[model samples]
Structure formats: C-alpha cells, structure tokens
Target: MRLQDLFINEDLSIKDAIRKLDETAKKILLVTEDKKLKGIITDGDIRRWILKNGDLNQSVSLVMNTSPKFVYEKDVIHAKEILKDKMIEAMPVLNDKEEVMDIIFWNERFSTKFNQQTLENPVVIMAGGKGTRLEPYTKIIPKPLIPIGDTPIVERIINRFNEYGCNEYYMTVNYKKNMIRAYFDDMEKSYSVDYVEEDKPLGTAGSLYLLKDQLKETFFVSNCDILIEGNYSDMMKYHKENNNKITLISSLVHYTVPYGVIVIDEDGSVKEMKEKPEYDYLVNTGMYILEPECLKDVPEDTFFHITDLINKYIDEGEKIGVYPVSESAWLDMGQFKEMENMMEKLGVK
Candidate 1:
C-alpha cells in the first residue's frame, strides 16, 4: 500500500484523523511531517482517547504513540523476527534517513489471513418487516430487496457471513416475500438459502420460533437492513466463552451535537452553558448470536420483538452479552440518510 495514503500530519485533529483512517481502510496511521515519521496512531488509540473523554478537536499528537516501532527497508528479515516475537500486526518501513517508506502487514508478509474461519452455524435473517423508514421505496420493494450498489441489501449481508463459511441461510420473509424469493431464485450461488414464510407479521424474534427444530445449535440472527464489518468468529467465540444465551452486536456511535443550550437548575436558573459537545454511545446494530434455547421462548406464529426476548432473559437472569465494535465496523442502512451515506462511502455512484 502507498505509505503516503496512511501518513497523516501530527497537527490533524483527532476527528479528522478518524475520517482519514476510515477513508484509507487501515486501522493504523503513521504520524508524519517533512517526509519523516514522528509517531504512530491506531484505531485503538482513538477509541481509548474517546473513552477517556478526550476532546475530539485536540491534535492527534496528544494521543499518538511517539515511540513507534519501525525497521529500515533493507531489514525485512529482522522486521519479521520482531513481528513474530512482538505480535505486531503491522509495522512501518523506513528509509536509511528514517523517512517513511511503506507499511507492511504481518499477515501479508507471512501469507496468512485472519477471520477466514468457516462457520457451520446457520444464519437467520429477519426480512419480514415492511421497511417503513424507507417509505415509497418499500412501497415498491421490500427493504431487504433494496439495492445498495447492484446487489440487494440482504444479499450483501449474506455474503459477509459467507466469508466465515456460513453457507446455510434461513430467511424469514413476509412483506414482499415473493420478490425476495424470486430474486434469489434467479441467482446462481454456492450458499443454500431456505425461506420461512411468516403467515402474519411476526415481529423479529417471533419468527425465529419456526426455526426452533432446525437450529439445534448456536446460530446467528440479524436484521436484513444492517451490516457489521467485524469478525463473526470473534463474536461467536465471545458468546460461547461468556456462556451468553444471546449476544447483541453493538457499535460505538459518536455524534457532535449541532447546538447546545444552558443546563437549567431545578429552580429554572441556568446552571451552566457551553458550546456544542460531542458524545459517544453504544448503539445496537440489530445483529445477534443466539443459543438454541432462546428460540423456545418465542411464541409460535405470534408477534414478538427481539427486545421483548431480551427483557424476558434479563428478568430470568439469563446470560446476555453486548459486544462492542468500532464505529466504522458497522453500517446501518435502515434509514434513508444512512443508506445514502453508505452508498457514497462504498463508491456506489
């Protein structure tokens, strides 16, 4: 990869650096000035900064790692040694004068890849709901049938799971079910898709009751409108390790409030006043890993939402987990604005 693409000035604010990271699709960046390496920054560094309530407007220099590990281009062998022993996923390569040359990924150097594990677990996609948020478009086609680029949204989601070797899909269809079925029928693909027709509007978890017998093992349930870019293997491992009956995949969402007013006191007096501030929250991405037992709780052919299932498990003291993923790791296409933004980011137009 081009070193210049991963190079950012130390003076760039944390917020702008984040955008740079997203644009480059690299989790790490070399902080440089005058064609030299000043430091290094990674996505983890920015997440930690946010957790510590650091100002997003602060210069990246404030949080960037000054003592970065790098090797001269000629010392590739030595770099491999450091990578193996140090467990570093990526390292920067420098010229004799300590000028940034390029970045090398450990996996690339060793011809290895991560998260390529094939998963045999069945994936249940909830495509039943009429995508009310999408409006007139949903009036013509189902939300899952809505195209992001050339492929439908649900197909994109299934493809991601297919990377993990999840070849069997159980799709719950209701609104515009015929259209969805017809689209997949015409496509020639390796993965096997099985449809579960919802006689009525079975809210989220309610439709999963149909799979109670088929899903005898741990499986995945996801909303057709959302996309998570993280590793499903890691999430499944976490769920199994924690003994969670249900695992909710959540992503960090950062928002800078467009305006800010005064904080009023109990007596209606202004307690404080400040400019617009940023906030971070863990938002559910409408994806889940579920143990087979959870399916039994859903009433057959009845309207029930996933949130209701979660509440029942909570009240019963069953193990439920929320796996936190990076903001860039999730793409929510449920809303029109978000869909447009995602299309733009993916270079759809």
Candidate 2:
C-alpha cells in the first residue's frame, strides 16, 4: 500500500475521515502535517468514537489518538514486535527529523499465515429473498447466484466466513434454490453447506426457526447479498466479552441534504434552518451474531423479521448490542449501482 494514501490532514472532518478510511481500505490512517505525524486514526478509533456518539462534523484532530505508537527509523529493529505487542495493523517509522519515513504492516513483517485464529461457529445465510433491485438479472438467476466480479455473492459471503474458520453453513433458500444448490454442488469447496428450504416465503428472520434445533451455539446470520470486510474474529470476541445475547453489526453511514432544510414551529414561526446539513446514522448491515436460545423467540410458522426479535429482547430488557464497522468495511450487492460499487471495492473488472 502507498504511504501517501494513508496520510490525512488533521483538520479534515471526521465524516470525511470515514470516507478516507473506506477509500483506502487499509483500516488505518495517519494524521500528518508536513510529513510529521500529528496523530493516528484507525478503524478501531473511529468505531470507539462512533460508539460514544461523538460529533461527526468535528475535525479528525478531535477523534484521533494523539499519542499513537511509532518508532524511529534508526531503531526499527523492534517495530514488528511493537506492532504484535500492541495488536495494531501498521507501524510508522519516523526519521531523526521526526517525519514519516516508512510504514511496516503486520502482515508484511509478521504473519506467515492467513486467518490464524480459528472459530467454529456456524454461519446462517439468508438467501431466500428475490432480489427485486436487480430486476433483469434476478429474472434468470437468484440473487445468491448474482455475480460480484466472477464469484457469486452468496459464495463470497461464505468465503468471508471461511476465513474465520467457519466450516459449517446453513443456507436458507427459496427462490431458484435448485440453481443455488447446483452451483455449490458443482464447485469444489473445503466447507459444507446444508440447504434450509422454506416451503413458503418467510420474512427475514422467520425461516431461522428451521435451525432452532440444529444450531446450538453462537452463530452468525448474514444476508446473501452483502460482504462485510472487517475482523470477524474481533467482532466475535466483542460479542463474547460483552456477554451480549445478540450482537447486530452496523456501519457508520452518512447523508448530506443538498438544499437548506427548514424546521418551523406549529405557529408557523421558523425555528431552524441549516444549509447542507449532514446526518450520521448507525445503519444495520443485515448481519448478526446471536445466541441459539434467541431462536426460541422466533414465532413458529409465522412471518417475522429479525427486528421483531430484537424488539422482543428490548421489551424484555435483554441485552442486545450493535457492533460498528467503518463505512468502507461493509459492501452490499443489493442494487445495480451497488453491484458495480462492490466490484470496484473488491478490485474486480
């Protein structure tokens, strides 16, 4: 990766920093002034800031880790050790003048393997929906079979879970399921996938009842059309550490209004007017890590959405957490535009 790509001005807005992070996909950024590191901001920092409900319009300087770990170029011998010890993604090497000389990434210096941390959790993929967004494409093949680059979207989702050592997958399929099953059966894979057929159309989380008895441990539930690119192991660790019964994954998404928005009082008095105001929201990414016991909450043979279950937990005052990922980390293939965007994000033609 280019060092220049990781450098950002400290005065940049936090929302824009998010854009930069997603743009680079390096998972880290160095806030610099004249090549001297002012501070550093990684995905973790942004996630924490977002969790605390920090202001998005504020400058990066407000959210950056002012005291970031770094090493002098002359004393680069322990850079790798420092990176490993700190559990950070990259190490910045500074010269005697205290300017950025080079950057050493964990994968470049330390890892001789990939996804060393193994997780045995089963993954439940919701592939039943007819992707009406890509109308012409879905008319022939199912959404799961829709290609993002060369690989099908569902396969890509499975491949991501595979990295976390997930071997067993339960796919809930309905529309053109035979084609999906045939595609998987034709392809050679290391993991196993059992098809969970829904005789009738079940809303998002309704078909999950089929696996109530089968999945007895903590498992991941994902939509077939999305690929979330982040550390699944870390997310799982967060789930276990927080003692969360259900953890829904989310992304920090923002939208800016093109024109000035006005808010008027009931008496027709203007109360507020802001030009091009931006709004930041923690949007659910349609991926979740839920305990098996939660499956009991799913109504039998009834149309239900995952939100219904989450609401039930909320009504019961049960602990339900939402894990946040960067805007760049989540990729969706739901729409025609997003399909092209997903391909671009994955660097496919």
Point to the candidate with the largest TM-score: 2
Model 2, 282-338: lDDT tens digits are 999999999999888898988899999999999999999889997777899899888
Each model's lDDT comes to: 0.86, 0.89
Q: Each model's TM-score, in the order given?
A: 0.81, 0.93
- Please identify model 1 stretches exceeding 4 Å from their true place: 1-20, 31-72, 77-89, 94-100, 106-115
Q: How well does candidate 1 match the true structure in TM-score terms? A: 0.81
Q: Candidate 1 — number of clashing residue pairs?
A: 1
Give the clashing residue pairs of candidate 1, or none. Answer: 119-164
Candidate 2 local accuracy as lDDT? Answer: 0.89
Runs with alpha carbons beyond 4 Å of true place in candidate 2? 9-11, 108-111, 114-116
Candidate 2: count the clashes: 0
lDDT of 1 by residue, 1-349 (tens): 5778888888999888887877777788899888799999987687667656688789999999999888898896797778766766789988998898788787677765542446899999999899999999999999998999998889999999988899999999999999999999999999999999999998988889988888999999999998888768868887898899999988777787888857899999999986797776878889999999888899977889999999999999998887766777788888899999778766785
Q: What does the lDDT read for residue 137 in candidate 2? A: 92
TM-score of candidate 2 versus the correct structure, residues matched by position: 0.93
